[model samples]
Target: GAGVSQSPSNKVTEKGKDVELRCDPISGHTALYWYRQSLGQGLEFLIYFQGNSAPDKSGLPSDRFSAERTGGSVSTLTIQRTQQEDSAVYLCASSREGGAHYEQYFGPGTRLTVT
Candidate 1:
């Protein structure tokens, strides 16, 4: 994809289940980040990967959440044992090699709704 891509724009899952959302970044972007935006909330950083390495993952809410980058261009976020409170818009963004200060282009996110 020319821009960021995310799958299952809407996901309805039961609590205690697992879900995997995918992301495809731009051609040359080496930095990818995941964030969650709860309803009526702002984007909360979850994790970031530079190429195939995840240098920062301090923002994951619990052990149930994890993400990985593959080949520096694609990424996926997995939420295991989903909880009701985990419902939110999972946004994937990418930037050309730069700091968090850099503006990132975002995907249309996977909106997870745990019921």
Candidate 2:
């Protein structure tokens, strides 16, 4: 399918280990976003990338979490020193543009478990 997709649908890592999650957005989409959904919690924004503009990292929980979009297409989110608290579903979404008016297409997400 040409829709947004994430790799390693499920990831299990030991505490203190680093993990990387990947997301592939639909072609031609100029806006990409990363979010996290923890148990019983609402979706938490993580980052946003729009074309060649500087990515918005304000939503990232901490310095341990970082992301990048190469060639404005594929995106990767890296978590350094994984912790149990970081266990959650990492979601990726893409839109035609970086605006609230544009609808975003979401991927199935990558579930991360730190134990």
| Top candidate (TM-score) | 2
lDDT of each: 0.90, 0.96
Every model's TM-score: 0.94, 0.98
Q: Which parts of model 2 have CA positions greater than 4 angstroms off?
A: none
Clash counts for all predictions: 0, 0
Tally clashing residue pairs in candidate 2.
0
> Which candidate's lDDT is highest?
2
| Model 2 Cα lDDT, one tens digit per residue, 23-109 | 999999999999999988999999999999999999999999999999999999999999999999999999999998999999999
Error (Å) of candidate 2 at residue 45 is 0.5
